[model samples]
Target chain A: MGVIGVVATMKVQAGKEAEFEKVFKDLQSKVKANEPGCLQYDLCKSKSNPQTFVIMEQYESQEALDAHGKSDYFKAAFPALGAVLDGAPGLEFLDRID
Target chain B: MGVIGVVATMKVQAGKEAEFEKVFKDLQSKVKANEPGCLQYDLCKSKSNPQTFVIMEQYESQEALDAHGKSDYFKAAFPALGAVLDGAPGLEFLDRID
Candidate 1:
């Protein structure tokens, strides 16, 4: 009902860290510039594992979150991002308690 | 070396959500008010599983994060919070890629 937070845990292919990050950063910038409802969109690398990365995102509402997935840039970037991924990313939706 | 984020994934005991939230909220407030380097401290509940909760936190540096764990308030609240946990929490440290 309120802000929605999405934690996307992903494992990059052993040697594709650079490719994965480049594609993701492009997507990140597009999301931030075009989606006003998207509050926080940042990429993070796990301190312990070079291959593990997480995308921490916050959206203003359900519609905004939905818009993100359906955006043209997101759709265009999906394949590139997936290509470098070790496997499917783990997605967990969280409802902000504030 | 830069801003750090910690994702704490915890499972609260069934029916202990209220107690867990209460203790966590108290700790959250203290962390927000007293810790100057704590940029974000939020508690979130998973949409799919009520028992699953995550604390999304950001610190200016690793030192700030270390201080959070050693704070007297954090020390006092740990036991109360642990009592309501389903199991040990999973902690992931992240280096912000920005």
Candidate 2:
């Protein structure tokens, strides 16, 4: 009913941070341009670990987040993202309290 | 120089979600009212597990974030919060890229 927030942690392979960032920038742009329900989409680099990225996203609702996952852009981008990640990303989904 | 984002995972002991949330709301108010550099302070509940709360915060800069940690409010609030949490909260600090 309220905002759906997502926190996803990605660990890039040692030498692949730069490459991963390049690919991610495009994905972020597409998320912003294509997904109207997506309220905020931000990618951030960890202060302590340069190879780790934490994506912070907010959607209008749970259904909106579900739709974002089903988008063609996401279908393509997810695989591209997986290839650079060290392991499966840690994802936590939440509903905003305030 | 840029936005400082924080993702903190808190697993509250069962039956404490309500209390934790109550205390947290007060803390959130304190952060917003007292800290000019704190751009955002949001607390969220996990959809699958209500016991887990994720705090998403943004600050104007690294220095602003540092000041937040040293504030009297934080020093007092952190201990009050820790009493309800299951274990040490997982914290990740990031610099927004987009």
Candidate 3:
């Protein structure tokens, strides 16, 4: 199976960018340190809109992608992230061509 | 100056996936071979919708990103790609946090 790529676009609350980023960074570090199946997980802020952010993620396979969502660190970080998010994130799942 | 990321989400016309991919691959190869400043340029197809594709790109700087847009090969591929695309692509420019 090909690698799975996930693009998550989020809009953080006006004053919560810093808090959102801190929580996201904590989650990112945990994912990187503990999840061998995850290939790439990076946070980025939109150039056109300060409130917008995107998480670019890559997993080895379907199982790996599922494992990421079910990981304790990922689940535990949700409430803090949700609190700072302006609305539901837009997610897109793709199959890496390369 | 930090790296710049570009997310280009495109929807190919039904039955034009192969043609669209071929044109995109040709462009991708040229970008990789000619542009040293481009860090990552990947093509991915949507898992949920076959017709949707996303090009994930990273550049060393804003100048590098501009160079890509102005490159001869990039400009040349537009016509073939545009013919197969369903509509204008959704483009998002980002500043890599890490």
Candidate 4:
């Protein structure tokens, strides 16, 4: 009942991948450091498409996701990076199925 | 360069969730048992929709994924289960980004 995962796909602007990576790396570190409920946070690029990125994040619960969304780093970092996105990011919350 | 992840989403038919679950659990076990290159294999459901299922599978490389696809169980299981699906599954291979 405690496990929650987030699946999000983002289309980073072609030339802005480097900047996106920089921000994403910091966000990853910050999420890991400040958020204890965050169990895993992984950043991935599409194999067939270099400009697309996917984030696989696992949290302890829905509360944890809420906490992460409300965190200073997420609030600031995500929006700052949003402008450079090539398209709208697809975000979904997931429940572990047994 | 070895880390590879597969993200696929399936829409299971209503009332056949139990059948899907049974087959899926067996597939999970089989994949884990036969594939050493498979690092992580997890099944997830959408938080808001119980009919939607998402598979988060990680392999050591594209070669590993190809091996998995060609493996006896995946070849048989996926297609057999596909017949019960409500819609076409979305499958994508992902590359690790640093």
Candidate 5:
């Protein structure tokens, strides 16, 4: 109910790295521009496994997260994410404790 | 190696969460106090699973990580972390891309 944190891992297919990042950059920019309730949404590339990417996101509330999911930008971009990813993403939902 | 980001997950042994967080708090404070190269160190608890904890840490470079691992505080606290955790922590090393 408080601020929600998300740490999700998506592994791009072997040869689709460029395309994955390109789509992600657009999603990142749109999220930043359109979602005020999205406090921070950082995109990271794994150092251990270069094909893997991690998204660290913060939302003001659960409602905000729902809103984000229902947004036009999210709808437009999510399919593109799934297309380039190797398999299902690994997601962990978190809350600030300290 | 430019800037290293780490997302580590630890699930405390049943009935030992209180102890785990206490040790973690101490470690967090010490890292902030002593590690100049650590730009950010955030502690988060799982919303989906309360016993799980996530630590998001940032270091200036690989060398800084080596220094962190070698610090007296790290040496002292890491064993405590292992003792309270249900299993070995899950660590994912990352680099900022956006």
Candidate 6:
């Protein structure tokens, strides 16, 4: 049973785009090293809104995602990331409906 | 069976962001009218590069996607879109691996 997934959209503070991207980019190596279930992790920025970004993650299952949430990198960097974010992130967990 | 889908990235010319978006916004009404197969159609731009955009489309299957490709709006607008694009867009079609 494969679960279809989606990109999670997060918004950064007005002047914190560079800081946010740097933090996210740094987490890349850590996330890749530890999260075995993460098939793909990509970061995308909004062309229209410089403060908005989309993070796309592909995982095997909810279990893997839960693990990812609990990882050290997630714990260590989330606070810094959260402080610079303007609002809550948007999550779209999708399933095929056809 | 349902098909897993991904977003397609498209880049606009250096100074044609507004024109591209205007054209895209116009296609919005047309796309919605004809492509019922399009479960979702979203447009996003890169925060780092306003000229870069990503169009995410979700469809039931390849047949439905084929229909979208042949739509009247696609035919009319793609040519205009092509002329302003700097390079080919990026595409990521995904499926669960676990």
Reference A-B contact fraction recovered by candidate 1 = 0.94
Off by over 4 Å in 6: A96-98, B1-98
True lDDT of residue B48, candidate 4: 79
Model 3 clash pairs are none
lDDT of 6: 0.70
lDDT of prediction 3: 0.94
- Model 6 complex DockQ against the native: 0.05
**Residue by residue across A36-97, what tens digits does model 2's lDDT show?**
99988899999999999999989998788998999898889888888999999988889999
lDDT of 3 by residue, A1-82 (tens): 9999999999999999999999999999999998899998989999999999999888999999999999998999999899
Which of candidates 2 and 3 is the stronger one according to DockQ? 3
DockQ of each: 0.93, 0.83, 0.91, 0.74, 0.77, 0.05
What are the chain A TM-scores for all the models, listed individually? 0.98, 0.96, 0.98, 0.94, 0.94, 0.88
Q: Which docking class does model 6 fall in?
A: incorrect
Local distance difference test scores for all models: 0.94, 0.91, 0.94, 0.86, 0.87, 0.70
Higher-TM-score candidate among 1 and 5?
Answer: 1
Taking all chains together, the TM-score of candidate 5 against the true structure is 0.91
Best by TM-score: 1
Ranked candidates, highest DockQ first: 1, 3, 2, 5, 4, 6
Tell me each candidate's i-RMS in Å.
0.6, 1.0, 0.7, 1.3, 1.1, 11.1
Question: Given candidate 6, what's the lDDT at residue B17?
Answer: 78
**Candidate 1, residue A77: how far the Cα is off, in Å:** 0.5
On a 0 to 100 scale, what is the lDDT of residue A95 in model 1?
99
Docking class of 2: high
Worst 10 residues of 3 chain A by lDDT: A33-42
Q: Ranking by lDDT, best first?
A: 3, 1, 2, 5, 4, 6
lDDT of 4 by residue, A1-98 (tens): 85887789999997999899899999999998999999878899888888999998888888898999999889889776897899889987898775
TM-score per prediction, in order, is 0.99, 0.94, 0.98, 0.93, 0.91, 0.51
Better of 2 and 6 by lDDT: 2
